[model samples]
Target chain A: MPSDLPHSHGRRQFLKLGSSGLAVALIPVSAFAETDDMLAAQAELFGDRPVQTGRVSVDLPPIAENGFSVPINIQVDSPMTEDDYVSQIVILSPRNPLPVLAQYHLTPRNGLAAVSARIRLGGTQSIRVIAEMNDGTLWSGEKETLVTLAACVVL
Target chain B: MTTIRLSVPDTAERDEIIQIRAMIQHDMESGFRVGARGEFLPRDIITRFECFYNGDQVFAADFHPGVAANPFLEFHVRATDSGSFEFVWTDQHGEVWTDTASIQVS
Candidate 1:
């Protein structure tokens, strides 16, 4: 049946449908899925507000030799002016017993929305950072670290 | 008693962004471990930290077990005036440790 669509239209549809169908049939549990604690923490922090993933950078080593002390740095792209500024930054760990790794409150006086510090990881997992602006917008970024030695979770 | 080490430029130009680093001796007990008797240890980590430039709060952090022991933090601020920078830390046991450093801003 010849249609107005391009020749690759049918192939594109087939590929999309085939992959989605295979996903439903084969992968019942995906590691990419967010944990309940992570979801709840995000919900509590964002409160149904959309969190766009950009303008935030999370820098951590790809492989941490020890989970007890890993240096991490986070920066948010902001002018840090009086009218517009980054209000808060939160770090959450899904694998940790307590999802909250740390919370930082910033203001225009800070002149920059950046911080560096050392953190502990319970295991190899992704660490998420959320930045809230003074205008009520939220942006986020994440970094994954593989820890050779896992540490105890924070209860 | 916690030994607090703070570093800040002794002098800075007006409106220049100044970098500050602070470290303290802390065990940062996670309370996730058990003793020989199998009872969970009580949390003994720093609960809060705040940095004040002159007198206004410039930066602050709320800690959790995920922060490594002997907490070290580095942040920045714009020098608006010649004054002192004060760092305060409060632990889970309601103990507070504070240190101050002076900065000469031109």
Candidate 2:
């Protein structure tokens, strides 16, 4: 009976170890890892051009009660004239499953380089908006939102 | 056929800045969800939206899955002339939904 008890104890231990290993693999990777991948994908679109951090303003609540529909407004201080205007505006959410949320293409016909929409966020993360001027200059703005409830959770 | 709604001032002063709003009805399936039977749902979303004023593009957007369903967009456009504003939305399947609104400028 004593020899049989030892064999049962060893089997139990092996099962426990296997279950723990599976748990670790099931856990999602840290948000930072996802952000790095998103950044690399962004670089492919805009190149390694230095992103100037001004001339654009991002408006959003500091704390979002719901991540499913967070209202966002972006405004660029451009005159929207033929000589100088914003050609493109991009919104990126690093933590979201798809980082590039929206890309807006504007022309001088748009009297203002401003847009407003509702976007989804996976969690507390930084939202970046980049404005590309017709002169080939890029300007960006960033805002952080603490999401109490995440939207894109895998069931 | 999908129902589309567009909001623009029927009349405006010349060169006045007018707000343009458009909404389309569609499910923006993010392609990340699994069905009850454990089958992956393919992504189907409106990938592009374009607004043309008097045959010239005034604004456009490239949308991803992060955007919510029934996409709504608001932006500013200079009312230069009284012409038809054409709005077009293209989905992943190459299907296009279009609507037009006319504006009068004094």
Candidate 3:
């Protein structure tokens, strides 16, 4: 009975350590789950298309004083012609309550593929913009912004 | 329910890039916060925005709960012809807010 007691005690300690290790592993896994959701959303929109990392520029303050009203300007370098214009622009905030922020549909009539707006940020995160050209090419730009006063805080 | 203020230049040169700004008075409640009574508030927000020039969509946006209160949007459009620019905002309640501005291109 004395030997059995020590074995049971060791098993209990092992279970305790194992559960703590699992809890530690789960934290990052949950965070990765959010990232997976973001990727899935992107795939849904672009269909696994390879995204080129140029031709689109996102301008925003490197440090945002307030996430509630962060100003953002996006410009895509394109000719804005009937054959070589930006057809669609999508803004995404991966860590926000929603990953997709806004989608702008454009045409040659727009004459420009630039847009400026005030957006809310949940915290310090990257703002990504993607442009779909008339020739079916996809270009992207991203800017990481540090938010001092976090917005979208659920209490 | 909110009031929208749309601003567009009265006149511009043909083919000029004219700036358009739209502002709306809205709280943009994200519905994730708790009320004073400790109850979860329902999310109420503007979901979509579109700009039309001479009956053609020039720019549009899909808004989320992450957008700030009293949303402000500024964009550019080619002043090809003298016509009206229509702006529309749709909310979570399925309510649509609309405003229009006329531009004269000489």
How high is the CA lDDT of each candidate model? 0.90, 0.90, 0.85
Looking at model 3, the pairs that clash are none
DockQ ranking, best first: 3, 2, 1
> Which of candidates 1 and 3 reaches a greater DockQ?
3
Native-referenced DockQ of model 1: 0.53
Model 2 chain B is weakest, by summed lDDT over 10 consecutive residues, at B26-35
The digit string of per-residue lDDT tens for model 3 on A111-149 reads 878888888887887888999998888999999999888
Runs in model 2 with CA error above 4 Å? Answer: A1-29
Off by over 4 Å in 3: A1-31
lDDT of 3 by residue, B1-106 (tens): 5678988999999999888889999988877678999998889898889998999887887877767788888778889999899999999889898999998899
Q: For every model shown, what is its TM-score relative to the native structure?
A: 0.86, 0.86, 0.85
Arrange candidates, best lDDT first: 2, 1, 3
By summed lDDT, which 10 consecutive residues of candidate 1 chain B come out lowest? B29-38
TM-score leaderboard ranking: 2, 1, 3
Per-residue lDDT of model 2, residues A1-155, tens digit only: 46678878898899999999898878666765888867886797789988899999999899989887888999999999999999999998788877899999999989899999888888988899989999988999999999998877752
